[model samples]
Target: MLHQEKISVRQFTILVFMYTLGTSVIYLPSLVASYGKENGWISVLGSSLIGFGVVFILNKIAQLDEKKHLFELLEFIFGKWIGRIISVLILMFVIYLLATNLRQIGDFITTQVMVQTPIYVIMIIFILVSLFAVKLGLEVIGRTSEIFFPYALFSLILLIVLVAPQADFSNIQPLFRENIAGAFLAVFPASEVPYFQLFVFLAIFPSVNKPDKAKKGFYIGVALGSFILFIITFMALMVLGPDFTARNQYPTYILGKKISIAEFIERIEILVAIAWFFSIFFKLTINFYALSLGVSYLLKLKSVQTLTTPIAFFVVILGIILFPNIIYFMDFSQFYWPFFAITFGLFIPLLMLLIGMIKKRKQGNGSQTPS
Candidate 1:
């Protein structure tokens, strides 16, 4: 039997919330504004329902096998070779996600703050920091997220509070304009990425102390995270209006730039940037951790620690390949990439769930006693 670490439900919940909210909070508003116009918040709220529904389905899968990771469950249902193939595909998908996110962060920092620095340098630094966090293991990662969660939330709220004076609610008037279809389309990427990515949590199920509470915690974490995105999206539209937001690469950052609580307290975008960095840091850490854990399970490695460095290197390479330049990356994200995400994140998992259910019924509902 593989030895498993234990983590509290609260810790797990915070980890999921932080992981879900982290990168999405930075890009979600701008992405949604592209379609929803002034009614982006409606799309955010609407998409969150889809996000939560994905979480609920994941939770149901987890409940069916108290201690088994999704990969193992897949093997049980689909037989060894096919299950291993699925596991490898899932791992590749996660690696792709990690790379894409790293590229986005690199692009953001390079274009916005560090135009002089080579993008590779920034990517290396971020990956190294995340790699170090993953080496400390999931318990440490969970605790770190718990500590930083408040600051992330505070920075977001502070942005809203400071920007309140400049906010023109009129910008969001005539809600639900003719772009209803387009608005929902915008919500798909933002909602699906964070929400469906919770499938990675299936890798960490054995580490959760009270396995039964996994469902409850997963739901709560995703809901809270989605709500945060909704609020931030609404604030961005209200503060900057959809037209300006869609034009800006980082609408949330622009919202921060607009804050001025008296002349002495201006240029607070740096503070917001710092807060956002931590959020992204936690997010990268979670992704790296998931990658490490998944690899450890697949290869039968005794410890996830051994795989972190090599995997971080792998991620850096992926980041480089993900985009020739920021413009190309953004264009891909806007047009082609979302359908791909839906295939791996939603369609694959749903198919596996059905297969697992049928396999269980064929086995006469016999529960395999844990060894």
Candidate 2:
């Protein structure tokens, strides 16, 4: 039997916001700064505009079949053979994402928070938490996200307010010096890795009880999350300077470190770390959940929960070996991740939508012309 669980619009909106904040807040400032320099925030804006377009496309695809989830719609839109091929490929990408997120959190903890702890231990603990969430199903994940949203939002607001003292608007000088091309070039990486990757949400959107509200919620969530990123990117440029921001692996963390209010309130970078952990945890859970669902759908299994353990194990193993080092990982994210994201996130979905539309039009004409 298909899972009958559903989440409210509010829950879905919270999930979308939390999911967007998950990895982008941790990595985007540095990456965008590196490409757009002093005007890096401008690049972020450009990327966000593209992100909105991607969301529009995704929303239309979701509306194409209110009753079918993304995986089911695949076979409906295409045909059995082609749809299965696409479904398998998407499943592989989803698993790869789970592994990447697992590795990312592990790397962040081992490098920034606890230099002495083993990375595998960190990965296992994170995986277990995500596994629990995935097993609980989408409604539970939605509720968990709703519960944590306020804390995460507060932490983010506090980080911004507290760090305001260190900001130097002069650091963002000569804003348009990079010209449109420079900013446009930065958009591919900045937006694709973070915002466009939201295509993954397609697999989960059908879980929403109010499908009509999904489009509105998605735009609101993406807009809000991108605005937060905009603020962080601008702040990083102003406080850390573009050159320094570009060079750092995690500029938001560095921004948190710069917080000092009369020397009495210091070392509150932990707040940023905490918020990042909360967001990333949800992100990992959602992706893992999607992966389990895909596996069950592909293998014709009855329950997604059964596949969770083996999938978690495989993810942990992949996370352990996926990246040889931090440099190579960051390099891949910069040069390679956008293309990978676009291929699955944008290209495949758009193609499916196009084909579905053509098929629908033909069927309508055929019925109208019946003898």
Question: What are the lDDT figures for the candidates, one per model?
Answer: 0.81, 0.87
Off by over 4 Å in 1: 1-3, 365-371
- Give the local distance difference test score of model 2: 0.87
TM-score of each: 0.94, 0.97
Predict model 1's lDDT versus the native: 0.81
Top-scoring candidate (lDDT):
2
lDDT by residue for model 1 (1-371), tens: 33266778998988888878777888888888887788778878877888887877777777667778777777876789998898888888889889988888898899899999998899999999998888877788778777887887788777777887887889898876667887877667766668767788887877898877867888888888888788888888888889998888888888888877767788779767877788789778877777777788789988878878988998898899878877898888777777877877788778877887787676664665432
Model 2 RMSD vs true structure:
1.3
* Alpha carbon lDDT at 37, candidate 1: 84
Residue 154 lDDT (model 2): 95
